[model samples]
Target: MRNILLLICFALMSSFIQGQEILGDWYGSLQIQGTKLPLVFHIKKQDSSYSTTMDSPKQMAIGLPVAITTVENSQLLLEAPAMGIKYTGEYDHTQEIIAGTFQQGGLKLALNLSRDNFTTAINRPQEPKEPFPYHAEEVRFYNESDDISLAGTLTTPEGLEKFPVVILISGSGPQNRNEEIMGHKPFLLISDFLTRHGIAVLRYDDRGVGKSEGEYATATSKDLSRDTEAAITYLKSRKDLKISKLGLIGHSEGGIIAPMIASKSKDVDFIVLLAGAVLRGKDLLLLQKKLIEEKSGIHDSIVNRSQEVFHGAYELIASNTKTNDALKEDLAAYFKEETNNSINAAQTNSLIESMTSPWMQYFINYDPTTALKEVDIPILALFGKKDVQVPAIENALALEKLENKNIEIFQMENLNHLFQESETGMPNEYSEIEQTMSPKVLNLMLEWILERD
Candidate 1:
């Protein structure tokens, strides 16, 4: 899911030297699935009044006027003096496409927008009908980085210091500090709950995610490790945070990153894993693809073929054998042939990008099981019994194989991928209802971190 705050905030920064009257109904899209949903951008110029209206098919929003930093015929640099996100929009007058990238730091990432009629509807996920147990805050911080200012939110108790601060690292994807999706921000809610319980939380927009500077898709896991390292270092320097008893928590792909951080940093006092994978990423992806196919009702024949292709791709990334240019050309040709007929270019790009990206490449080559042994901290690994995204059975077995004596395992019964309760165990269970991290699981984690302090 594209973090909307980042997209809309940066859309205003374009370096296009627009024509005398470059105002019109503009539209664009952030390729999610295979479809180009409407991202309607309307630029108007009337007398001395210069303004723009932005809309999208996905949600209801009113566009705010942008401060035109610079406008040249084909290229435009626009800035939203209000939000501070700047974009350099390249206009193709003939095709009526304003696309290229939205830049913040040194990274220029892809962004595509156009012009069309926009529809609006609010899809906010249902809030908990049951009383919520936590109070929270979302305060942005300015992280000092080389190319851009990294931004993050610090969630803590209503008013207190010397709390056991935990840095929440995101799993794979360009995730904001909230780890938002389809109207629900899981990490934000998670932070809210944890903080109300007396734990301090530090969660940030993954570099290039929300307000953070960098390219999300191109970032490798190692790069994320550095980002997390920066976060940990930042916490240690703070007078309010009790850095001596710090903890690191990761989920999904984050599960892998937690160990990577703990292996290098002596500052981290404990670690927690929720639905963490303890196997090779290549192997994990295959299982995930198969499970997704099964849940989505994909045909077995097609699933088999996809598995073969993915297996071959994974092997290529991991192989030590040298290859000639001809082989490379052949592989490239095969990839093109396979995707040439996709109906949605963005979905096709998503598949190709997911497979070909640096992080994915690095991820597919390494095994997390190896890292678990080296992670010599007080470790707690938990998995939902019904999780399909990362099978609880596989992860539990891997944890069992861990040589460390300090490891703890909690097998949550009837829980779905997100640790929400679901007995059906069907793949559709995750989306059918709203669920949050169980209070039991949350309490266990807090106790683990606080006890050590």
Candidate 2:
């Protein structure tokens, strides 16, 4: 999965004509899939050169530096080499707009910037507000293994002296305590729901995000598992609250993590997985790419071709036969030949860098079947039938193969990866939908946990 943050393109400093009309802020809405994302380019004049910064208001990210910018002959080009984002457009003086196409990797979308401010009215009604019915406290804990302090919020039902508590583990991306994304705070809502029902919840920022202290970019899933281990250690030390039962509630990548911890840790009493993967990492990613590409309306021919290219690349990486440098060189050559030189060097480099990252390398080889089999605790795994990211049908089949009596797996009909009732279940539709999470999902979790107690 991509980062929960909407915009990845970062600023450009280049020589341009003086006193150009594109000097101020230019607003645009990048429509990907069905969701509309607002983007702003703050162009400024600096002596003989021009500097540009980008703002993604929806994601709360601003003042992002652009890598390259050029304007000449009523045409403008903006490129962020690191992110593989490139925009080439012509400034229409009559319409007072810059008609452009935004390209990143294999995806391309129309993005038109205008002088008028473009804003997407964000409505997330399910987010809990204060005068909350529970007791919430800001807490700090240390991951002794990493020697770093992590910050989070712990919420418990009012007047509960002893209770079962679960640590809320986020997905693949760097997320805050709330798992804030696309104007939605699913973790905040989840904590509120569970706490109101008499279960304590602890949700924290990923390392290097929000108030946490540690580097996230380089940390693999195994490293993140240590952070959760610290939270478990912290909960056990709280003699005042007396947490009776300690369980884990993990979503997406967290699903993979929950099993990793439960298989070895005697401290974990139970675990819940939301949209978890049952297949091997490489297999899951390949399936994810194919499903998403087909749903996005790409022709079968194109999807098949793209899938073949990615499959080859993933195989090379998984082989581990060559040094990192040699592997990168091989990947570069392979990609160039596969695409017939259609992809630019910057895009190829960005793709190679991501596929070769520590996390990607680990994920490509990870198989959670052994971990899942070793877990003796009660396990609850839920999947959205409409989820294209982790398709329920395939995972459910895999679960059937396990036949673990302690595990209970359900495929919720018509739900998406986020457990929201969805039609298409594409990532583009995640921000457009109003529901933070389906009430049915919340109720199911509550009932299951309460029954266990």
Candidate 3:
């Protein structure tokens, strides 16, 4: 899931370039699995050099820095070393377009830039309107462990002196407080609905994302768990809210982190898992890749071959016996041999770096069952039948094996990972769907939480 976001955001940034003729804003769209992600590049000339920034309108990311920009002989180049992405495009002056290829982690995609000033807006009907019926406050809390302040929103039902509260933990990626993706703010919608129903909700930005402070690139899931613990502690200190019924509601990666906290802390009263993974990270990712690709209509043979390659890679990483440099060299050789040298050295290095990051290393080997088995509090695990990312049957069955009488698992039919009633249940359809969250699922969650005390 993290890799998917990295690819999408990197491809969007690929359209950004600094060229003499490419000043102002250049727009482009990267087509991924039937979804068109609209990207905009703001380019300006600074003395003899060029400066550029990227905007992913669909993803609601703006002013993303392009670390290196150069134009020579009509060839435009943009590089963001921090993200391990590079783009090279040839400016066609006659057509007023830049023909380019975006490359990251040995994957390459065609991304042509145009000066057409294309603007896109997704109509999210379920997104709460202003003048909300709840009391919303912008709040900040410090993560004492990481020495960083996290920014978030706290929403409470109007006229409620004290109320049950749940902290919203987002899925993977560097999400803001709203958990905005493809122009849909899931956390905001969830918070609004819960607050309206007399439940207080707190949703914060992930470390180093949005208004929060910390280094997201280097932080592992354990570090994120500490951040969540900080939120719980911060809430306990609030006199305006009741902490007696405080709990956690996490989506995907956040779902896993909730258990990690609950297993160790007595502060967590309950937990709701939304499309959480019950399998080990490597197993979950392999299945996720296969299912998502198969749903995207990729040939079985291709999907099988890709899975085989990744399986081998994952196995090597799981061993955890190799040093960083040694593992990088081994993986590079493996990828080179598997791809028949079609991938270049730079691409291989990029892939190695991403696969071996602190977070990825931890996630690939971590098993959520270790924490889930220890959680004795009431648990509500929900899954969308169409969620290819964490297939309903495999994960739900795994959760059931825990045999904890306090846990209840439900598989919502016709819904996707994001809980929207979906057709194909692909991530691409999340933004296109009119609903932010299925009312049935939301109601079920509210009922479960309310029933818990």
Candidate 4:
């Protein structure tokens, strides 16, 4: 569920004497693991200096400022200090192109930019248009425990005195209120459908993302549970929503967080888990790697060896006695040996850093069964048969072990993690799929919620 927007670079190099050549938009794509992430650089001349901003169309990130922009001798240097990104490229005047290498986080990749703006359009027909029938309002709420203000959208049916409400907990990432990814706004569409059917919905941005005010990188699952609790508190104060009917609808990691909150908080009456992970984080990730690799036609022997290396690394991290430095050194040695020294130091260090993050550490060690087993409220857990991230069979089986009469599990035939009707169910295909969410899943969820009461 964590959507990492890989940074793409576009260098606009031109002679200062003839700045007009680089004054417009330059387009390029960064090829990362078979995915072409489209990037657009909008450059403008301001007196003697130039200013530029970048847009990542695939990730829906726009107007990201370039901290330093310089052009001299038909060469360009664009640096974004915040993202640790730097691009240096030479301009070919006759070809109207810039050939460069984009470097960030110890990885260097080639990127070529052209004057012609070639945009890739993704069609998402389910995204709701403006002038929605329901009442949509921008709202803010406080998480007193963390002392941060979170912002989001609350959609309610018009003319309804009181209605059942559900707070939408986004998956693992710094998502906006819409849970937007690959140009699809699933949360907005879900809110629209639910609100239109007489259900009030609340969906907020991850802390430190969008309008929220908290540091995302430093927060853990426990910290996120507090934020969800705060959302419950905010809704309880509202007079137009039925407090007794309040529930939670969580996707991916959010699915895990919902049970964490509901196990203790009496406010949550029901919960809906969409593509939730029931297995421990380490097991879930290993299965995910195997499934995705197999689907990509990788050999079983290679996949098994890869899993073995990852398992060793995860085991080292799970041990509380190992210090961060020791863990990194051990993991690096293991990776080097497993890859026969083919993996470079920089890439190895990058992988180690990501694996050692606070979030990843907490996630790998945290087991959702402890929380799910304690949740006495009615629960509906849905999984997609083709979902590679959290395989439907394994997760659904894990949930079934809870044996809680209040819990109902369903594995859909052809849906993906995002609940979209998918082909291979790979993350790359999420953008290409025209459907935002399966209408059948939406109807099923709505019916389950309506029947709960």
Candidate 5:
């Protein structure tokens, strides 16, 4: 799961200036820990009054109401009290930019908004240009369990009479077949590389995303496994493709689901888990929060306090004893007391709603060990040494203790959750890195799969 606190705290920016064109969309990117998060400000003038809203495109949040907007002496100030965000800027007519600073809590970053919504184009050199080598097909399959149609791409080598096939399971969020994020299409590249190497690859949009049908916001990980099962069924039905072996290559939460299916299905021959969690979901999220905060240079005391707050909240959610309404009241009272009533009811409600969501509740309590142990098929689990979200040390050690003869684990050094060669292994550097995935990791996966084949 993505860090809810990080997203909420950083859903931030905006600006305007006196005597200049400011009644349009102004765009800029906030540089946080070497990560570029783009924000847009929609400004309009209404009968001698000015109003504005903010958008954080990177977070998929738009039209966030700005409580206050004002301009005086050619300087513009905007504030969103609910989110504790403030932006101050001055329009440089010659430069055609609103040069400013964005502040939220103790964090502040330089932001420059322009009429032209242009940021430096992120280079994705690894993305495939053309597809002459492999046969690529846009396909649709039915998730009969959910009564949803899922769309995806299937690629296979040209000359193979029968080919080994694997379904690519994306990590969290509503991803398309490409599993596109931060301008990186890891799944598409994986599909391309493996198909070119004679493995048939099937990757699809999440249930409610892209061309697929169904709702997404309410679905949990177990719900998503049904989609993967559907993909497996679809591949099995395509007997003309002559599949030699079937496997699953899952990243992050996908790693969790792969075992869930492989444990029950007789058809799965192998499974590859990338940064799968060995710790229970609750423990994993706690570790993730601490590591990310420390890496981002947050003070120790603050991190500890935040950890304490979330730990209690997760415990409450995990208890599963209260009705939804009762849980909300309890959570509201708990948060208010924990924060010394500094947080407003709206903020508390937002926190309560997110923590109590179907996905969150399921993830906090779900343990993959049972499924991992039951899966007798060959398993390859890889972790990035620098991955803070699913840090390798504890999880890798946990898997090692499992000592399942069928399970093999490896850790790649200096890599992040996305498997990109990273300096700090923070999510901020994902887009800045040009390589989609480390060649070493990719080669290892290929070699491992082919050897098993």
Candidate 6:
């Protein structure tokens, strides 16, 4: 799939002058096509130089302030090491607004700033136990794509007879080859286990992610599908490959992409869905809101407000609405209501903007349900009962809608979004828990691969 970033750039310019009290929270929405994306800049000015943070309400953990190094003319740049870099917002003195420019691979817009008070939480993904059961080597391959050759690792058994090969696909959100999310790298563990169990596995970094080429923020998951199809085509061309059968396995968003490739391609013989979605992404996000409320340990009133904010932002994105002054106001009001007595206003506004960015808008508009039901290959779908990221309970129903009965479903009772154990469904439980992949998932996948025709 081609990108739509360049075709959808409106005005996102702002004006700022010297000797001004830039110390305050600046808020505004970035526009991508018809949708309005929200964003916040918590500007902390200390004399001539200053530090600021650009954050997303959707991603609380990545909300750390970034140091600003150089400022020349109207352009201002901010760099946050742990996450990614952001270049946007012009200093505006005429309007007293720190206007939005380009962020998260979207258009530019101006933000109004005022001396506002707020608090924030800084989070780094915790390390967790390996997901797969066995040990395997990590290898990289590069080729295709005009930007950079895609790179991926190969995991094979110790003895290495040409064994059945399985190529892993990650869900969404700029994942590494291991599909690293937070602390757990499920693909790494899965490849380790499957290869050691007499299977060959290949998992790669998404293009523009991890040692791969291309700009990630400007790409789509459909692009990843094309990448996966390339990986499969590459494997088929190799003489090193063994066995008569080939397989494709995916987790979360990867699960959705797996089916897309299998449907059109002639090579993929078996498929595995690890917490894949069956519903439209927009609906799935609503379910995600509910999950977030439960996980955040919040009240019902707060939950309702959050839903409104999420849906409103979603409507703007799906319809590709032009972000105007009114859109920004609607967002700020929603965040104010949601964060009242809960999170700091600045932080809340940050989250709101981050979720509505151009790329995020597109992600929510894409659905995997239609594709999941169309793949004709043998499918093994697994869901942890505790999984909140891609609620298995809701996805389980999609199996009944498959075009054929070739799909097999397996649901594990205690697993959460990361396949980590959680009795009460709390996210912190993942850090407290061990073994991100259930032993049962390994057994089921391995057995299915061996038994499939």
Top candidate, metric TM-score: 3
Kindly list the per-residue Cα lDDT of model 4 for residues 1-453, writing each as its tens digit: 542312233322222334577778888888887878778778777787767767775554555556676667888887654345678888887898889988876778888999766544667889899899988889999999899999999998888776789999988866789988777899999999999998999999899889999988778888898899999999999775654388999999899999999999988899999997899988887888788778767899988998898888788888857787878888888789878987657556657776888888898898999999999999999999999888899999999988999999999999999999988888767777889999998999899998876
Which regions in candidate 1 have their CA more than 4 angstroms from the true location?
Answer: 1-148, 158-161, 320-328, 333-351, 423-432
| Candidate no. 1 TM-score | 0.67
Q: How do the residues 1-453 of candidate 2 rate in per-residue lDDT, one tens digit apiece?
A: 642212244434444643477789898888866767778888888877887777665444545567777777888887776667788998988888999999886778898999886434768889899899998999999999999999999998888778899999998867789987767899999999999999999999999888999998789999999999999999988888878789999999999999999999999999999988889888898898888778767899988997799889889999977788998999999999999998778767877887888899888889978799999999999999999878999998897799899999999999999898988988767777899899999999999998887
TM match of model 4 to true structure: 0.86
Off by over 4 Å in 4: 3-26, 30-72, 77-88, 91-97, 101-110, 114-120
In terms of lDDT, the best-performing candidate is: 2
Residue 357 in model 1: shift from native, Å? 1.1
Give every collision pair in model 5.
none
Model 2 alpha-carbon miss at residue 253, Å: 0.4
* For model 1, the run of ten residues with the poorest summed lDDT: 1-10
Native-to-model Cα distance after best TM-score fit, residue 395 in candidate 4, in Å: 0.3
Error of 1 at 304 (Å): 3.1
The residue pairs found clashing in candidate 2 are 10-65, 11-65, 11-66, 11-67, 12-66
Q: Could you tell which candidate, 1 or 3, scores higher by lDDT? A: 3
TM-score of model 3 vs. true structure: 0.87
lDDT of each prediction vs. the true structure? 0.65, 0.85, 0.83, 0.82, 0.84, 0.64
TM-score of each prediction: 0.67, 0.85, 0.87, 0.86, 0.84, 0.67
- Residue 57 of model 5, lDDT score: 50
**Which ten contiguous residues of candidate 6 have the minimum total lDDT?**
1-10
The count of backbone overlaps in candidate 5 is 0
Residue 400 in candidate 2, Cα distance off native in Å: 2.1
Provide the lowest-lDDT 10-residue window in model 4: 5-14
Instruction: State the lDDT of candidate 5 residue by residue for 263-309, as single tens digits.
Output: 99998999999998889999898999899889878899999999999
lDDT of 4 at 186: 93
